[model samples]
Target: MPSMKEELDQSTTPPLCKTGCGFYVNKETRGLCSSCYKADVLKKKASSEVPKILDVNNNVGNQEPVENHDQSNKVVKKKNRCHVCNKHVGVVPFSCRCGESFCRLHRMPEKHACKFDFKAAGRVVIEKQNLLCVADKLEFRFFKWWELPDMVFQSYHGWENWLDGLRLKKEVKDYLEAKIARRKIV
Candidate 1:
């Protein structure tokens, strides 16, 4: 029902991206610009694709989305062999600290250039495995000679009456008598 001129005008200047990318939108893309459209396409392409990482600050000035690395080594290992490499495997396939399996040629960290800090991880393990032990000093109780006489009476229960009958030395008897008098006064 539209005229030729109307169709021409619509085709001449493609609509601005609905996402506000400032780029001309493609009708086939629904309303997004080429870059935004590509990103959306990639996001829905497969589950193995590395998810788009957003900046922490999320500056309003830059609206573009950050994508993953294109390099084979830098790209994430999605499947068994990896999405980029099509799961290519060598003779020996072993997992690394980077959370990906590598081949015989790239098994060593030096070969694949692992990002995990071996030294720091080792230090943490060592610290947990070997702990430092420190204990408090032991305490001892000392009793004076004057308190020893009282201790003897307490242990013997009723030795007060037999104290003089024991025929003890005069000095000992005098000491016991003095302690007994002190006890009666209290």
Candidate 2:
């Protein structure tokens, strides 16, 4: 018969870790070994503590308003609450020309029945459509600097009648020239 020690050694099963660490671990432990599980638990505890610290700092600083900070933050928080639902809004929230900050759900002036001028809105739409039509007419047309005077005269009736049809007033021409100069430099 085999010796008692040899029989016992043969019957004993090797320890195995659940995390595939190739190390011996207690059979009752799940997933990670003892050391890895402890480390993981410590990491989770640290992350949770960090968020609490951040929340504390944010609350403390915001509780009392500072002069150097954005005054709009305080104003928006207090007065610019959503006009319809009275909910607080963040920075750059949509505000109607009628002087009210509206949440995404009620951002449109018509949705809130704002007293905006419908005539002004119609004028703006007409102006935009006119601009689009002008852009479409000039889309494929290209002219060099030397051809500018000829093109302008031809497009209008002639040099003398150019001022009648052409809308380039002296102030507008100066502004456009300045803008073109700035664009060239940039």
Candidate 3:
């Protein structure tokens, strides 16, 4: 059996309490300080005396769920809901083609043709805003390569070309044509 001092020292060492709280606590309460030990005992004692239940009739100040007055009058504008499921959600590294925000499920499929920019040619280009594509008479906006983070731009030649065109302030074709050709097996 170790001496009481040795036992206390072992428990109060720095390694044991590296999580902000120091290790040395009152010996009577293991690792807890005297105040903490007293507080815990008091809380337990108070909880033990609480009544199990009470009649609702005796409570007069309670209220039911109230509907918000402003909420009823307000019309929520759906801003860039996901194209796949149309759910308004926030996810990082999101892809936007022609102003539509596509969640991961609907964006970037394994299909090579789908990955290419079909609307890259006729799509609208907003000088500082976006790059839009229209396919089958449906409009889609893809993220302009320039708008991407700088670190992301350094990764791909296609993106670099696309960004160069955008930065030069002239409209150029989307560089995803190779993927389209590959998909057609041409």
Candidate 4:
């Protein structure tokens, strides 16, 4: 059976539910079945009432406004909250292998083997709960390989070593070249 997203993509006209119900995808929504939309509204209302953060008086309140925190003693200074997991991430939290700043829930194991390279030259995570979004994973893998340093990236067999023959960017590659040249002359 075709999923709703598949059906929507296939239809020339805007797709309606099989029940002939028109959906309000406009204003604060994507494609949502009527039942789901109502449920979402209710969920939002309930969630809005819940205190997301503590106020100055230590009472429940909405998200706190951003302010610089001075914590010189702590090893990890809490900076911002993770958007996905809603946990306080310390200053300069390591981006997940997925490029998402997941507090802990969505991040993969922090190991070299778990890292995936994205198609657009950046980092991404490999493992997941499901394989439904495989294309995204592949793109992310390519990105990581292209953008970040690989194992032994400083060595001759590094992936970007092929580009060694190409003209180097003076601003970016000059420092490394200088160090190498100095070592060779010594």
Candidate 5:
């Protein structure tokens, strides 16, 4: 048998605790150190007591039925129905500025005849124009070749411009016709 001094030395050597506490564990307790075991007991006791406290507190409230109280505490979302359709409930409803909810089919203000202020809508249009202007440089070189014919025609014709506004120069029209003829012949 080891002597008392030897036993004392072994115990004092700081072996790893099973509870991952980083410090040496007490040898008297099975695997767990005294502090960890006490913590575990306290945690279990707290968990068990929580539900009992809730139940007691719930019963002590006013004279509403238990089922009603349970349901009332829970947030029950009202199903959104379309103002126009009045039948089908929407999963993803669209809300208008006019304070009316709508389905996908009648979400637009025009579709529902909503009385939204036109001044507010004009601001959105102006913002869209500003965004387009910011996205492209206003230099003459950046102008598209396709728009050149229309721009030239519109400047001279003014009120006499065609409804489609696709007037091409006489030379360009003749060239396109010749190309189409050549393709057909081949």
Candidate 6:
């Protein structure tokens, strides 16, 4: 059985690749032949890749390019050698917070002369994590029980056992108690 799209395509004269690749067009290839579409996609990917730092620096005055964080992460992942000594950091690479991977010898900031301010970064992290709550001072005025009115005492006093409740006969209490047994409100 043919799909709805295939059935519809069969009715039409069959669109060719926009690039004139002499092949039948389909939705998957985006109106292009499979090979042509793949080549196009690869070309687009290559063009979209982050420009080198040197190229970026050269073009700084002409136009400001958007910073890509994914490129930065990729650079870190690709760095298997120390930026300082150029030694290969095998297996477990010691990655510094300075956005550079280093060998065991030059892992420390002091060894590599890393310009990243550790104290400032730490301060910023602390500031973000430890939020200082700004609120009006709680005006909790302490009061003595004797100083309060009788109305306040009536509600709070003997809250569990209602002393002012209507007195029920012992037989009625037993019947209700049996029916409501083992049931808690919560």
Q: State which candidate has the highest TM-score.
A: 6
Where model 3 places Cα greater than 4 Å from the true spot, the runs are 1-20, 54-186
**Model 2 TM-score, all chains together:** 0.25
Q: Name the weakest run of 10 consecutive residues (lDDT summed) in model 6.
A: 137-146
Model 4 agreement with the true structure over 1-186: per-residue lDDT tens digits: 889998877774545543346653433345666676777789999988885554578644655766656688559634366645577767765575454564555455443234555543422233343345544343333233233444445564643454465455664356445544564521
lDDT of 3 by residue, 1-186 (tens): 999999998876734322335554655675576666677789999999886565677654675644548666888655556656776657453455444556666655432124446455435444336745646421135544333565664555545464455553233343334433454321
Q: Who wins the lDDT comparison?
A: 6
Stretch of 10 with least lDDT, candidate 5: 138-147
Q: Rate the local accuracy (lDDT) of all candidates.
A: 0.69, 0.65, 0.54, 0.53, 0.66, 0.70
lDDT of 5 at 76: 56
| Candidate 6 global CA lDDT score | 0.70
Off by over 4 Å in 1: 1-77, 82-87, 90-92, 139-186
| lDDT for each residue of candidate 1 in 51-89, tens digit (9 for 90 to 100) | 666778877577775565667768653445631234566
Give the per-residue lDDT digits (tens) of candidate 5, residues 115-134: 98978889988988886444
Error of 5 at 165 (Å): 54
- Runs of candidate 4 exceeding 4 Å displacement: 1-10, 16-29, 52-186
22 in model 3: Cα distance from truth in Å? 3.0
TM-score of each: 0.30, 0.25, 0.20, 0.17, 0.24, 0.37
Candidate ranking (TM-score, best to worst): 6, 1, 2, 5, 3, 4
Clashing pairs in 2: none
Residues 1-186, candidate 6, lDDT per residue (tens digit)?
889999887788678899987988878878898889999999999988857556554656777757656654664346888888788889878988888989988999999998899999999999999989877432232222233455654676541233225255676445434533443211
- Cα displacement (angstroms), candidate 5, residue 90, comes to 5.4
Which structure is stronger by TM-score: 1 or 3? 1
